[model samples]
Target: MTDLDAALSDINASAEEDVYVPFEAPEQSELDQKINQYFEGVVVRKDLVKAVRGNAVVPGYVLEYLLGQYAASDDEATIQEGIDTVRSILAEHYVHRNMHMAVKSLIREKGRFRVIDRVTVSLNEKDDVYEASFENLQITKVVIDPDTVKANEKLLVGGVWCICDIEYVHNDSPGSVPWQLGSLKAIQIAGVDFDSYYQGRRSFSTDEWIDLLVQSIGLNPEQFTSRGKLIALTRLVPFVERNYNLVELGPKGTGKSHTFSEFSPNGALISGGEVTVAKLFVNNASGKIGLVGYWDCVAFDEFAANRKTDQNLVNIMKNYMANKVFNRGNIQLGAEASMAFIGNTSHTVPHMLKNSDLFDELPDSYRDSAWLDRIHHYIPGWEVSPIRSEMFSDGYGFVVDYLAEVLRSKRSEDFSDKYKAYFTLDSTVSTRDQDGIRKTFSGLMKLIHPNGEATEDEVRDLLEYSIEGRKRVKDQILRIDATMRDSPVRFRYSDQAGTWHEVTTVEERQYPQLYPRSWNAEAADASGSDLETYAPPIVNPDAASSRSVRSVAPPLPIVPQGGGAAVIPDDDEPLFEGIRDFKAGQKGVSYENLLLPYLVGATKIQIIDPYVRAWHQGRNLGDLIGLLALAKDPADEIEVTLVTGETDKPHQKHDQLLMLKSLKDAADAVGVVLRISLDNAKHDRSIATDQGWRILLGKGLDIWEKPSNPIADARQEFRQIKSDTTFTYARIPVS
Candidate 1:
């Protein structure tokens, strides 16, 4: 057989084997069933992307668009047929750069041939015609008509993935091109019915819909917390919100550039991190527009520190990012493209907050206050977990091309004022700060609740999340440029009942010793003692439980414009009576930092949480017992009792008891007595001690989500908080 024929045979055999695997299939989940029921023709199994994508290097959206046409079904036979069809189509038509010569020869032999490739158009003013360039076919200056360029204008800016037909003729004449473009089709959904999409969205609950969107992005929502899901969805804001400016910096391997590059065809990812003014904004010399005129989002990838950039480009960017308009040759032009900058961070968050600012990794040109102030939100990318093979979902989700079209349609709707009915920002927040929060909140609302409906509590959650994102940008600016600290900004909000709540970044709360209360020069110059330099001390668990220590001063309350009470931590006295609230997704919290202070001086303790039957919950009970073992003297024995509920199922109850019995034996080896009591009616979760302290637990031992990595999860402080809880302390009744 010929070499080309042999290659095709090997690909066919591999495709057949990869299409199906022999295994016991799990039962369909409720959400997956609902997805297929409601959006049957627009959903497909997410795992099918990898199975069918053997060597075809194309954007995910392109492949999904094809899959949705042939394989959007739950039936195994239908799915296999669709996969085989897609693989055959790719094998016959998709152009590989290395095999371009073969494809070109085939076109010449057949007089006309069809292939899938990325096509870009450029205006040849000298020739007074438009010429096309095929990326993988390695052909340039193929004669293309002006009407085709006008119909698909995105071809002029950063190119578009397309299926095009080429006609070639043998020509011996001098100075003549033989390549001809017959037709072209971009690989995207042509149109979507907005009314139908809006009505379909009402079929699912908010949580279910959010999970659908997360799965559409190819992530398993079961593995992420609510906050982590939000962080992942925030990357789509630039697509749905017009003229939005966002910045995200964190460690590598977090998939920061994946959405912009592969999620949507309307977004363009500039991998070089630097571009000339002519290509990005406008070309004054040629009187042509740039990427902003064609794409919905222009993302800069690998944008790090020390890259030289033109001052004129930065100036034009600041104006366009702020006002959504730019000046070119005395003419004003406006477009709806959003801006995003994503890069890697060399230092940890604490290290940056202590010695430098978070924006220290950005180029000096972008580090200007005026430029930075235009950013609407700063995603704490450190909170995002790195992408793993297991993180991808195998369940059904919407074909991304359809979802992209839906988001593009949503860009025209505005929901910025939806939060005003529930809460109000503090007067100390500047106009720019308010705009940032409003834009971020508006985008998230559209993504989560497209029906323009949300409860007061739900609106409050989005509002606080929005404020925290913008506050991270503003707080780092205070550290980057001291001159901007003259006008201090306080990030606080007031509820309808006049209760004030201050929003703080998680890193600020985690490392209070590194963060300052005030960023002004006078505060820093006054005394080094103003900011505590010591970390949270690890007290010897072998010491007696009755040890005493000096108490530190408490933080001040955040009063609103209208005088109102706010909660504060009571660190001034021993045996304090107050509640400390932790936000969701906050890290660096643990049993030692949270409970050890109050657990001191207690010889006997009772954990009243009733949900300690699962393996993770049993691990939590063991951790508490281990804490007691550390707080007491090595020779002394402290009695610890756990009151939990028993399962109704026979096998589950048997396993729960076996796990607890094993934990009890491990506790006895450390000089602590472990006792378990099972009650079917136990509900309230709390920890009571014989030393006049009753600590309320909001989420019991299940405050944290399941861990992803062993090394990080081994330490409590490194785990992300899955739920928000308040630990209220009060004196026992002494009955």
Candidate 2:
């Protein structure tokens, strides 16, 4: 065994080896080892969130603490049994918002029985005694030992949220309070053995470690392509590194704040309010630290700006975000918390590019160049799919408390310099730009290679990723604040051979308009704008490119705003017969552009795709109905027959029927009769119409993936298809 493996194995061996994991899945087995072999003793399976979680709403860190105590065993029965016990404890001892009176009665009847509640401690100067208050239980002025107050002073500030055991003493004794603190502990604490964490880290390869983290979040890495996996992993950055400023702006349902709110105890996902100086930084009137001082990460959800919020608050946050320190009166306080901004975009990528910058929706005050420069990374939340039920893994991972502690501990180390050996950053990069790159580099390194053992390729991938993230931040900044057009923030690096390498962000290459509006001005683009735009590049090489694309028709078709009838020209609405690219922020073309023309003038269309088994696939068919309504004559009836596969699994037939039936009913309401059939031998996916038009599709009826919401899905063009699949549209003249 490798030394790292032996070290991890030795630790596991030394502990009681009788622990068994439940559910016996391949993913579960991998999760079991990730905890024992790599993050041994320091990680917890997050799906345990569902098992132990009851009606009593509690933070994840608290349950993780309970899990680490009773359920941190490898034995399946032990884990299962532990979950039951934890559930029981929560039901009985944990305080519920509605059952506070009942819990109080239990404490009174039991003569100081222990119950779980949030305990905040403060000194009562008049009595010269320390007092504690239990949140939700509505109990206050409970006496606490001075040492207890001293040991957990976080309570004195914003009130450390915790699960505390309070004893209720009904005493007629004079000068004595009925409440007493039996036991007190913060809801979250991070105490990690960095040496052992590093030692265990040496055992796994880069891919293995990345997979472990992806699994830790209760997701299967195999489900996501490599780039998709990386996109998903970017959410973990704020957890591992301190004072890391990040933002993920995209459509809703992408689960942007899911990690901070649900996974770890140290992070908080607050509603993305316009910055408030008192809430985030400090409240000078109360002489208390704000969220920044207490939490490891503070994610702002629903974060799009209205351009009307208080500018002073925005300025204060900008300073804190950049410097990791905020001024409170005369005293300046430093905090270790990272900041994250998550929100949905109001406009389509193309609409924004043409009408406004990508950052246009942000509050005008927040769109300041000074603030954008502080962010280390910008995860394209657009790239992530809505969290479907299938995205979660049924596996074993460390109790979150263990992982939280490990991440908390690594905040002190600097992995930003680790990549310097293999590559040298260009001197032209600005200080803020360098800071952004280094912070991103440092966080990814700590996540994938905590032991600092990375091959040249691994290091370069991370480095390039780091630079790209920062570039996303900088590129948008220029578009938002034209004054920054002169900034020298080029991301260039050189290898040991002095072979200089320049990094171009994914958006930069695809959306070259940000540099010079004239770059693709004459090339035929997807937006179908008047300018001559060239077909953009495709991520999938097999997918054809429209490099030589030219507009066959001078005028673009204008369908009614809300799926109303379209005014077709005399010549078959000018069939779009050229290559079209939809990657990057490219606008205009969508499933509507691809499917509508061929779908026009056809009364019957048969969709042959085998994988229409899930709700999303069924929903894709539903959307096609909407498209059909737009192209319908309204006087002529339309027919759509679905030829999909039937799996042999139990309930498969029932589920497929139920889903298709719902779709069929909806299709009937729109002047269309929908047909469904079972086709076992169906391999190829295509759309055949009565007009002798047969269109070949790379992804079958699965051409359009799930968008952020139902509304976006209804508006076909608003949704972005991350998959690089091709579609061929051809019409045979009544053969």
Identify the candidate with maximal TM-score. Answer: 1
Q: Which of the numbered candidates is closest to the native, going by highest lDDT?
A: 1
How big is the positional error of residue 516 in model 1, measured in Å on the Cα after superposition?
2.3
For 46-108, candidate 1 gives per-residue lDDT tens digits of 888877777888888888888998999988878888888888888899998999999999999
Error of 1 at 634 (Å): 29
Per-residue lDDT over 182-251 for candidate 2, one digit per residue giving the tens place of the 0 to 100 score:
7776766546666876777677667777777787777867677777788777787887888899988875
lDDT of each: 0.80, 0.69
Q: State the local distance difference test value for candidate 1.
A: 0.80
Model 2, position 393: C-alpha lDDT score: 64
The residue ranges of model 1 lying beyond 4 angstroms of the native Cα positions read: 1-26, 520-735
Q: How many backbone clashes does candidate 1 have?
A: 1
RMSD of 1: 16.4
Candidate 2: global Cα-lDDT? 0.69
Clashing pairs in 1: 541-630
